[model samples]
Target: MADEKQPAVAPAPDAPREVTSKDGSSHEEITTPTRPPGWMYKGFKVFGHELWYASPLFQLLLVSLVCFMCPGMYNALSGLGGGGQVDHKAQDDASTALYSTFAVVAFFSGSIANKLGVRLTLSFGGLGYVIYIASFLSYNHNQNHGFVVFAGALLGVCAGLLWTAQGTIMMSYPTEDMKGRYISWFWIIFNLGAVIGSLIPLGQNINKVAGPVTDGTYVGFLVLTLIGAVLALCLCDVGKVQREDGSKVIMMKNPSWITEFKGLFETITSAPWVVLLFPMFFASNTFYTYQSNDMNGSQFNTRTRALNNTLYWLAQIFGAVIVGYALDFAGARRSVRAKGSFIALIILTFAIWGGGYAWQKDQVTREETAEEGFVTVDWSDGGKKYVGPMFLYMFYGFYDAAWQTCIYWYMGALSNSGRKAANLAGFYKGIQSAGAAVFWRLDGLKKPFDTMFGATWGLLGGALLIAAPVIWMKIQDTVPLEEDLKFSDETVADVAGAQGAADQAVTAQPEAVRTSKEGGGAKEVV
Candidate 1:
């Protein structure tokens, strides 16, 4: 008889162990103390054991679904050019209102998320999307742009909360090696909401040549967003989540409101390198108004716009996958992947935007000569002019995904702690929203199309130039565990099973600055 195989022993807390991958490869992973099974999943048996509802992947899936129903549906409507209205001005003004509030609230929403917990924050966030969608429905009948703008303002506040929590979880939940793929998965599911939601308008008004989206289209979106609001409540608390390797997710204990703000200030002061990415963040969402209203909305008829919106989101999925795989490729070091992605993005950015520039010039030329403004292109145009613009729009979608994926990956590269991730996410959204607000207001004011277009192109190039040195100097093969876990009074006991011991050694100590094992570390917990 063959010798009995011995049971594998678990690694001690904070011990490094070699973990085998499914591809018959292995790498070292540090194990954090594991928590007891969450009460929510207790006694819920599956295959003779408790189901892991508090699993990292499962919780990520839950968050993805929530975004899918909320922002996903919102994107579908936005893609229809001016929220599927004949006039672009109303939608542009509403967007300006939305981003204006978003900039302010998102800057501080990280503290709110940390205080209220992700579940409540996310649930509250979903409510704004519901109301925003309804505003569109009301506008469909009453044509009250004020109601729409009010809804946008309200949604911006809620969005700040929702997205800060989401960013925390997305950056924190995945293992270091899996961050890219996890982001890709979340993005795919989230955008599916847009793709499926776009179909509602397409199916409802497929035969209609050129007009606003039907009332039924808004109704469909409203229903899905409501479902997402409820789903937000179902997320498991952070401490309960366990990774595939049995380590719990990293989280710092909550401090006072004063302390949290101080922490934010500290982050800004100490990690000033992060400021380099501000231009990139600011430019991130600024292009949406132009893409949605100026390009897709102005150039295509209702049915064709719907079709282009579907293809646009579809391209987003593919773009995310391509970048995600490249970023997470196992053969290269993480730092190598980061540098490689940066280079590829630069190349792709200039190339795609170059195409956009040519297209914009053509549109400008046509508009100058046409007596009645630009004519909307329908599929009936026999693909002469339609196919070229269609491809351009899809590539726009692809570049959007690639750009966003890189930003998220860059943020993820900075740390693995949820608290820090929340702060970073807030800062990112804050700057991004500010830039978007400016651009949306410009579009709303009916600024010259070529002027806005040139600004967008110039900003993208300039931001990348500023961010280049920071990427090369700061990003690394890996983040040190101690550096990542800094800033909280919590210990391994806080996140692990030693719940009763968590508060035993609490003290009012000031923040400590330490040089990380990785050479130059940022400020951390005392």
Candidate 2:
């Protein structure tokens, strides 16, 4: 409220607004209709109107593209060094740093997104991924690990911003009826980074290239990332995201630093969030470190990395799409979808996966070089005939798909309104980063594979186990099924609920694109 007008109380619950913060701050956001004078999009046309360019669906696509590029390149690049298996501790060291930094950065991402607007926040975060990838061009194996850690830190900061932006925008663009479909599609498009990035390394790791990394191929990947970064910068600004009634979703409020700080504190301290810390926090890091360290090329040749990732991504794509439908099929109850999906993602349910890992553990042979890093066991004896792990890792796609979609989608239910929802999404990634940082500390102290399998089951899988019962029995969102409601409920009293309604209609536009207004003018609310 520092730089904005006083909040206006909504006459109805269906109104595009929140009446106040949980912290007892009395602020009523206003939703008002005010379109730019119609010339901004120029001649862009769909159905003969120059309005299609401004549609939230179009904006969502641009946002998705912004989310795609850098991480895709990083996924391809992160798998490159140490024979794609040997120097995994180094990989953990870098990743630990990435997530550790990400935790702190994520705490602030919502406020940053609020202040800078979504498009710019996304661009800023994407650039961080690009820079982290570029830093890899100078990797010199054992001699330059510190540089890798530094690069990881850079990636961590941007990732906090990027993921928060992604979650907020994705959640903001769909109406109650189509959210499941949209969330499912969003997961597929976003997770394509993993699938698509896998191909780059497959090409780069050809034995003909000799070393684990090929400089020329890596340079090409950098160029592709550069192009992607530029495109992300071209997305629509937040002030332009219009709702179904032509009232634009405004996010321009400049709340005091004290409010932002308190909001961050409140989010981390919430009961629902405390319950999520064990199973979900650090969950990605555990899964990823295992993937990067153990199963990647442990029992097979480096080329198999691409084959492995290809299958993993494909399965995940199917998993993501199916999970979307599953959630929708479960209907509007957040408790049902959240609990049901958690039970389904229980990695242990796929007992065959653990069996497969055990089968491969005996097969892969490793040996260390004369490098000081040789202090570690060398599994490099071409590791056993790596045939089983490729298939084994693919099973995680389903697990990952279920975990990612449900978690991000459920965040909307946990919060009372859009602004709080943004922060909750930030915590989803942030606290996890803190946990990842701690797990990654296992890097140099023990055989990476031992820690990888142990932590993967212990955390990623454990989180699901803990969440299943807790979400079912104990935890519930303060704003349950908030996204499922159509904004207006007949039971609520209203005096002037129709005041903000606009006559002009939007087709295929998002109902979630909330419009806000204050006494002086329309204030953008995240």
* Candidate number of the best lDDT: 1
Candidate 2 C-alpha RMSD relative to the actual structure: 11.0
- lDDT per residue (tens digit) for residues 194-239 in model 1: 9999999999999987668899999999999999999999998887
Could you tell me which 10 consecutive residues in candidate 2 have the lowest summed lDDT? Answer: 488-497
- lDDT for every model? 0.82, 0.58
Count backbone overlaps in model 1. 1
Q: In model 1, which residue pairs have backbone atoms overlapping below 3 Å?
A: 487-525
TM-score each candidate. Answer: 0.85, 0.73
lDDT of 2 at 166: 76
Predicted structure 1, TM vs. truth: 0.85
The C-alpha stretches of model 1 lying farther than 4 A from their native spots are 1-51, 364-374, 493-526
Report how far residue 11 has shifted in candidate 1, in Å: 13
